[model samples]
Target chain A: MATVALKSVKKSYGDINIIQGVDLDIQDREFVVFVGPSGCGKSTLLRMIAGLEEITAGELKIDGKVVNDVPPDARGLAMVFQSYALYPHMTVANNMGFALRLAGVPKAERDAKVKDAARILQLEPLLQRKPGQLSGGQRQRVAIGRAIVRQPKVFLFDEPLSNLDAALRVQMRIEIARLHSSLAATMIYVTHDQIEAMTMADRIVVLRSGKIEQVGTPLELYHYPANVFVAGFIGSPKMNLVPVKVQSAGADGITIVLPGGGTAMIPVQSSNAAAGSAATLGVRPENVAISADGPIAGEITVVEHLGGETLVYVNVGEGPFITVKAGGDSAANVGARVRLSLKTDEANVFDTNGAAMVPKVRKPLADLEKRGH
Target chain B: MASKAQKKIGLAVLGWVVALLVFFPLIWMALAAFKTEIDAVSSPPKVIFDPTLENFNAVFERVNYGNAVFNSIVESVGATLICLIFAAPAAYAMAFFPGRKTKDLLMWMLSTKMMPAVGVLVPMYLIFRSTGMLDTRTGLVIVYTLMNLPIVVWMLYSFFREVPKEILEAARMDGARPRQQLLLLLLPLSLPGVMSTALLSIIICWNEAFWSINLTASNAAPLTQLIASFSSPEGLFWAKLSAASLLAIAPILVFGWVTQRQLVRGLTFGAVK
Candidate 1:
C-alpha cells in the first residue's frame, strides 16, 4: 500500500477550467472518498490520480516518488469504473486474471490468483460466464474482483455502485467497505452520494468546481463544515440557509436578524464578520424542531414521509422554505400553521461570502482542561 | 374491426400484384429457355411450349459457361477478401485513432466512389492494356477490389464506431496491446458487420458489368461478360441471354438468401444507438 499526494494539480479543457488547483494527501491504507455533485470535478480528480487523465499542472506522487508522467499501468493502481468496464469478451476468470496474465504470470499462478479472488468476491459460480451474462451487481463484483487480483498498491473506484439498484448498492457498498479493511490497501472512492462518503470514508474530501472545499473525517465535516457549500452538501435533506444581517457585535457574541424579522444571537469567533454586515445562518433540517411555543412561525408547505422520519417543508413569513425533520408518527399536514425553533448549538453561521463561522461553545474547552492535563 | 379484415385483404392483393410483376419476366425466360428457337421467337409468346434442355445444351456448347462461372467466383471472392484486408485497418484507424484530417480524408475517399466509373474508363483501360492486365483474372480482381474498397471501408468504419470505446479502453487497462485489441476485441465485436460487408462486396464484384465486359474478352470474362456474349449479332437473343442472365444471378441470389437477415441488420446498425 502506498500514500498518494497530489500537489497543486489542475485540469482544463481549452478555456474552460474543470479543476482548479487542488492539493490533497491520501495516507497509506486510508479509505478516502471524494464526493461532490456531478460536474464538480470529483470524478476528474479520481481519474487524474488513476493516471487515466493527463495532469494539466503540478505534481502527483505515489509512495513519495513523483509519478505525474507515469502511464496508468505503471502507476501501480487499479480502477473499477462506474460502468464496471469488464471486458465483455472475457469470462469472469480471464477478466479477473487479466492484469496478472499481462504481467506474464504463469497459468498455474494466474488460475490460483483468480480463484482466490473469486472466492473473496463469491464469484466461483460465475468463473465461466462472460460479463454480458451477468447482472449489474454480478458485473460489479467481477469488476471489483478484477481490481483485487491485480493486488495493486491503490484501488480507485469511480462511482462503482451508482449503476446498481438501491438494495444491491447498499449490499455492495458494505462489501466494498469490508474489502477495504481486508485488503488494507490505500483506496480512493469517488461518488456524489453523500451517505456513501459518510459511512465508508476514513476521510471525506468534499470538492466543488475542482477545489477541495473541506477534507476531514466524515463526522468532522458533518459537525464542522468549512463553508456553506460543504454544509449544504454534506448533510441529508440539505441544510436550510436563511439570509441574515448582523444587528449588533460584541465580545460575547453577535446578534443577527433573520430575513423575515426575528433576531437570534449566536456566539462565533471570526475576524472577517462585523456588525451591520450580511451573513447566512444554516440549520440542518433534522436540527430544526417544531414546537407548540417556538421563536419562529411558518406555514407547512409540504411533508415528505420517509418511513422512520418525516421532512416538513415550511415557509416562514417571506423567507425561503425551511425544512424540519419531524417524527414519522406525527401527522404534520401541509398548509398548517406551525412554530419552529432552531437547535442553536447545532446551527452553523456563515458570512455573506459563504464562509462558515464555527460555533463557540463556552463549556467544552474548560471541561477538557478541568478533567485532565 | 370490420375494415381491418378488408384492409388486410387489400394489402395481400396488392402484394401479389407487385410480386407477379417482378416474377413475370423470370417466368417467361424460364419458359422460353425450354422452347425451340422457332417457338422462342413466336409472336404471341407460347406459354405451353414443350419443355426441353436444348437451350442449356446450346449454352454450354456455344460459350464456356463453366470457365466464366469459375472466373466470376474467383474474382468476386478474391476482390471481397482483398477489400476486407485493406478496409478493416483503414476503418479501424479512421473510426478510433482518427487524426486531424481524418474526416476530410474519409470524405475524399467517398468522393472517389461518387465519380462515375466510366469517367475514368479510358485511363484505366489504357493502364491495363499497357500493363498487359486487360484480360487477366488478377487484373479483374485488382480492379474490383479498388471499386469496392470505399464502400467496404465506409461500412466497417460505421460498424467499428458502434462498438463502445470503453470496451477498448477496458482492454487497454487490462494490458492489451494495440494488436491484441484489434484481434481480440474489435474483430469479434464487428463480426456480423464484416460478414455482411464481405457478402455485399462479393455481390457487387459479381454483378459488375461495365468493367468485366469492357476489359475481358475471353480469358478472364466473368458471368456478366458471359451473359453479354449470349447477345448475338442480331438485335435480340432473349431466350439464350435470359438463361445466361438467370445463371449469373443464381449464385448471388443464394448468397443473399443465406445472409439476408445479417445484411439488413448490419446496414441498419448505425441508424440506432
Candidate 2:
C-alpha cells in the first residue's frame, strides 16, 4: 500500500553508533528482508522504520511523506515482535482488535476486522482464548493477526519465527509468505536466518556491523555476492574461502594455485594484480565434487549425513578444511583421501581486501527464483 | 525408612512449636483481655480464668474511641489512596522508560528510607506547628503519604518490571499514550502487586506510633496513640491495655486475613528469578 524509504538514516547513542548511515527504498507491496547476524542492527533498522526508534540523523519517509517525527501509531505501521507481545489478559479476538479499539473504532467494525483477521490466521477457534492459553504457534499467528487488523501501510516483523520449533517455523514461514501475497502490502522483515530471507524475500538486504553489505534478489545474492562478507553470510555450510597464490591473469581468467597444491583458472576479471600475489578462492560445497581424476586431493576429516545429502569435510592443508557435498548414499568417511573437482565458471576469486573480483560474463539463469526446484 | 518418618514428624513438631512461640504474646493478650485486673496480674499468669467483659466495658465508658477510629481510617486510607495515585506513575516511568540513571535513582529513592524519620522530627514538628497542621488528620495523612511513598514506588516499580517491555511497546504501537498505557494495561495487569503494596502501606500507617504520638494530643490521635494513652501513673493497666490492643488489632487483622495471600505472593514471588 505504501513505500518506505530511509535516506542516510543513522542511529547512535552518544558516540556508539548502531545503524550507521543506512539508505534504502522499499517499494509498495514488496517483501524485503533485512538479514544479518546478531548485533548487526537489523532489528534496530526495522524498529526505526516502525517508528519505535527515532531516526538519529536522517530522513525516514513513508508514502512520500517524511515521518521522522511521527509517533509509531501515527506512522501507519504495525510490528510483530519476536516474543509475539500478545496481551496475556485479552482473548485472541480482543488482542487482534486492540489497536482498533484504541483508535476508537466502533465495536461492530472492530469485531468485524478482528473476525476477518482471525479467519485469515486460522484463529477463529481460538477467539475466546487468552494468549497464555494458546500454544507458541497459535500465539505467533495471533500476533500477526493483531498487526494485520491494523491494516497499516507497512508490516514490520522482527524475528517472528525465532521462537517456533523447526517444523512449526517452516509451516509458519509458508503461511507468512502466503499472507504477504494475499494482502499485497509492503513488508519489512528482519531475521538472522539466511534460509528465511532466501525463501521469502523479493529482495534481501545483507547487513553486517550496522551497514548494508549488499541488496539483491536471493538468487542474485547466492550467485553473485559483491563482497566476501555477503558470500560467507548468504550460504549455509558457508562458501569455502581458501588463500591461494595467483599464478597468472589473462583475458580468459586468473589462474590460481588452490589450497592443496592444485591449480584452477577462475573465470573472473583480474583488473590486473601481478601474478604470484595471494588471493582467496571462493567455492560452494555443492560445486565441489569427489572424483578419482580430479586435481585437488585432501583427506576427509568429518562427514555429516542429512538423509538426502552428505557433507564431507576435507583437510586441504591450507584453509579451514574445504567441504564437499555428496549424495546421501556416498561412502566418504573420515581419514579417506578424496580428489575434488570444481565447476570452474562458478568459482569466485577475492583479492586480499575481501572484495569479490568481477566475473567477465554473467551467466544468464532464466527465472531462477520462480523455478520450484 | 523409619528415620525418614521420624524426621517428618520431628519437622511438624518443630514447626508447631515455633508457631506457638511466635503467637504466645498475642494469645496471652487475648486471654488477659477477658480476665479481671487482679487475675491478669497474677504471678503464675492465669491460663484459664472466669471471663468478664468488665475491661471492655471500662474502655468503652472511659474512652470516646469513635473519633480515634475515624481519624485512623481517614489518615491511613487517605494516605494510601494518594500514595497510589502518585506512586504508580513514578514506578511506571522507572520500570518501563528506564534511563542510564534508573538504577541509581531507585537506589537513591530507597536510601531516603534509610535515614531515620526521627532525625527529621524536630524540623517536621516545627513545620507542622507553624503550618497549623500539628494535630489534624490532614497533617498525619500528608506525613504518612510522604513516609510511605518511597516504599510504595519501590514495590510498584518491581511489579511493573515483571511485565514484559514488549507488551507496553505493543500498546504504544496500538496507539495508547502514556496515561492510557498505565491505566488500561499496566494497572490491570499488576493489580495484585498494587493491592499488596496498598495493604502493606495501610498497615504501616495504621500502626505508626512515633508520628501520631509526637504530632497529636487528642484531636487526631489514632488507635496507636489511644493504646498508648491507656498507660497510667499508678502502673500499667494490664487488662485495659490488653482490651484496647485487641480492639486496635481487630479491624487490621481482618483486613490482613482477607488479603494476606496477595501480600505474601507479591513480596516473595520475585525473591527468586
Q: Give all TM-scores, in the order shown.
A: 0.89, 0.94
| Position A148, candidate 2: lDDT | 97
What is candidate 1's lDDT per residue for A31-110, written digit by digit as tens? 99999989999998888887767899998999999998887778888889899988777899988988888779999999
Candidate 2 C-alpha lDDT tens digits along A99-216: 9998999999999999999999999999999899999999999999999999988999999999999999999999999999999999999999999999999889999999999988
Which candidate has the top score in TM-score? 2
Q: Record all residue pairs in model 2 with backbone atoms less than 3 Å apart, i.e. clashing.
A: none
State residue B113's C-alpha deviation in candidate 1, in Å.
Answer: 2.3
- lDDT string, candidate 1, B103-202, tens digits: 9988999999989999989999999999999999999999999999999999999999978876676666667777777777788888888898998898
TM-score of 1: 0.89
| DockQ scores for all predicted structures | 0.40, 0.73
Q: For model 1 chain A, where is the 10-residue window of minimal lDDT? A: A364-373
| TM-scores of chain A in all candidate models | 0.94, 0.96
